[model samples]
Target: MSIAKTLAALVVVAALAGAGITAPPTATAAEASPPRAQAGEEVFYHVFFRSFRDSDGDRIGDLRGLTERLDYLEDLGITSILLTPLQPSPFYHNYFPTDFETIEPKYGTLDDYFAFVRGAHARGLKVYLDQEIQYVGEGHPWWTRSQGFAGAPFADFLLWRDAARTEAEPFLDRATWPHYDGRQIGIAMIDLNNPRVRDYFTRVLLFWADPHGDGSGRDGVDGYRIDHMMDDLDHKGVATDLFAGFWRPVFEALRARRPDFRILAEQADWGFGEDWLVRGDADLVFAFPLRGALIDLDKDKIVQAVRETEAITQADKGQIVFLENHDTDRFMSLIDDDPARARAAAALSLLLRGEPLLYYGQELGMRGITREDGMSDSNHIPLREAMRWSAELDAPGAAIWYRGDKPWWTEPANRAHDGVSVEEQQGDADSLLAWYRTLLALRQARPELRGGDQRLPCGDASEVLCVLRESGDARSLLLVNLGDAEARPALDATIADDRWIDLIDGGTVDPSTLSLAPMTVRILGTP
Candidate 1:
């Protein structure tokens, strides 16, 4: 009846269930029993193609560089690599595609791309290509057709906004809101109403998803990270219909072939809630609402934001956690440079519902703001400030920040003297990086922390924000002191009875009452 007793019962039942489910072999197991993606556990890696250096000192980052980093990625427990577009785009970011079939030569040959995929698969890492279908580069061959692009039902595929109504319609105005890459000569809006265009788009997607070249030439792609999906205009008032139509066949087809294939849609806003599931295509959506609050100065404010996110998004917290991604300003800079607060945010991110994305430098206390250089410039590459790798910079259960060539955007703040490098932080047991890694590991080790029907463990949810995640009998509790000063909050440890173990501090917690340090976060569960 009590929370502890309920949790103990659940654990026993789970053990019985798992006992019947034969355990997979260890790392030394044969190839046939190779590791697989853990359910409810997914990791995404954001790779910038142009920001890498080849062995020859070439300025471009190619598939080979990524291939080489597979172990590094695997070490971090990343399950998938979300590559920025590899298509032949005129710019370095690869978002503006000139050729869908070709890998950017600057990033190496198509063969290199193939090798990267093969390498990733070898490491059991699924690869997801960034799909930016809303727009194409100004120089795409389709735009060059002189017949005004009349290809059967695809004639209206490329949209041509009414020149007269351009003043009233904001999305149609091209000259004013140019693309991020300067080379964009004009706007790249396509006519989603055209079925032919839709079919063509589907064909392209299917082509990539087919590993046998049965549809196009390439084999199946494991997953697709749809880009700027929210940017397209839905003249028919059924935006979900259009995007879903474009994807339903592809997703169904891929699942029919590779059942484990994933689709992570970029639903930056909250509109795609039901459609994401109805379409049965996307496995994940960017939790932007959560990102907007994670950086707020007030911990209470952040917790309140989390509660709202749980309510508004209608997504199972276990499936839709927040992330500070490549598109946004770094979390550190956005949070006013408070390292402790940053750790608190990190704790919430790793412990809360949904999956968490560790943007490259995020582990190293990196900081930077949104700038005109574009998202890639602001948070991805330019923020790659030098990371400390000295023995002193290590963190328990954490990997070194920069195991390879320094990224192009190395920060001056992370220089040797500041003692912020991975090496320096590694030495300080309470370093932000260490705190993040420890809390993350703790969250992963406990099933209750993964999110389920949540219960506020503390008597007062607002002041001390105590949350309990439970599935059947498995339970994990997260407690944060939202108040500025030390506050001891009382809680029903058992929901029915008061007893808990403060996992973070390694102390037995009597559910009836507990004192939380200012902005403190603790994970509690039976070992």
Candidate 2:
């Protein structure tokens, strides 16, 4: 081996030996298990905990705040709330955990979480927690004890290397490891192959899934959104087969307890595929590539991607389709803040055939985006900024970014706070927020639109991408002009009944042909 490679191997081996990890952790099918992770056709609202609401007046959002908003969410037509990580962490974005069992104090206590859960359940809303089991933050007891101590119980918990950079080569900072999403975000990848770690995490999940230890199964979460759900270790041998064996057993155990619990995976790759089902047993995976198409406001890309997603997904498994989530920039930033484009994007995402997930403040056109000039880690904070409740600076419930008391984020490039609020949009019939309410309310009233097969009606045309969602005898046609000017697409008059009905505003459409306004979407149904 070259001197550098040889030295590297030695350094890793030394660290491992000193950490008391003689070998990799052992695994078995018996080690992993779940609550039957059930994801029925329901609309989801994704909320970043700290940014959503602050009931304590501490400038940070808490469970009390979340609980108080359940009525609002229910009214908004969302059936569930997909929360970002709430585990204790040193960072503002709590993807990495210092402790999994405890809730971040800023968010509230365990009692608060359970209360929020019970409250959501009362409102007939399901809640799913974001579970990122792959990474650990700086001060986690496991990391400190395993790396520095001689007899570390968690020595097998982390991925380490060997060779010649001294004994401390492998147990370095995130910049040196950069194991997550190909970014050095101050986190270290766990050695997921270790069955002991798997068992430990399973216990953690089970604890949350059934926090009350009661047989009722109502106090815990509906399921989990698994972060960075991967198949195996990249460069390592033997451990590459860990995912199938590890996740299956875990899921089996969970289902043994609660049959209806839902588990969704944020798989590494996002396209037409069912690999996550057979390999990892994840019930649903985020359809990222399709989401990419919607963000561009491209008619063809979005239409084709939706049709492809529906075709590829199996009956038992599904793809969670979304235009904006916590990880990506707000849809407002992507669509150039045009109200028309926002309306078009909302219709494309929420109306299409998939489990729709709407980010909090998405209805009010909440906007935030990271700049290219900023450091990579610093960029996501923009997208995760406070949920703007009102444009009024002194409003009692107005949100402030939690990075600092008063930071540089106070002045954002997008300036998302202007005129975007529940107060402003509540009564405005033509507002963007009003548009979301209309779309979600439509989903609630129409069973066909909720869980139906999607079809592209205007195959012969490219400028206007028309989609037809049908279930039983009920059908809805979504027409959008993807250009600056009007485009008329000729269709069989028989596609609709003698009279056409627009679901958004109860307007009428010509049965023989459709003329679309610029950057507009029309929902045509038989009246």
- Global fold similarity of model 2 (TM-score): 0.85
* Predicted candidate 1 versus true structure: per-residue lDDT over 261-363, tens digit per residue: 6677776455424455444457677766666666563555555666665564444313445546656666777666776677677777777776666766576
Model 1 alpha-carbon miss at residue 299, Å: 5.6
- Measured with C-alpha atoms, the lDDT of residue 324 in candidate 1 is 60
Candidate 2: where are CA atoms >4 Å away?
Answer: 1-38, 162-186, 234-239, 373-376, 399-407, 413-417, 493-499
Best by lDDT: 2
What is the TM-score of candidate 1?
A: 0.76
The number of the candidate with the highest TM-score is: 2
Each candidate's lDDT (Cα)? 0.56, 0.70
Q: Give per-model CA RMSD.
A: 11.8, 9.7
lDDT of 2 by residue, 1-527 (tens): 11122223232323223222121111122123222213557788999888788786777878898888888898888888899999887667787788776778778865577678777776677889999877687677777776755457776676655322112212223234332134443456677778888887776676567543343355667788887666764343524565676677777767766788778888766545477765788788887878888888776677677767777678888877787887788888777788898888888888887788988888888777764543444556667766777666435554564444433356653354477777777888888877888898887777767887777766555477777778888888888887778887546555744566888677787734667778878887765
After aligning candidate 1 to the native by TM-score, how far in Å is the CA of 352 from where it should be? 0.8
By how many angstroms RMSD does model 1 differ from the true structure?
11.8
Model 1 clash count equals 21
Error of 1 at 422 (Å): 4.5
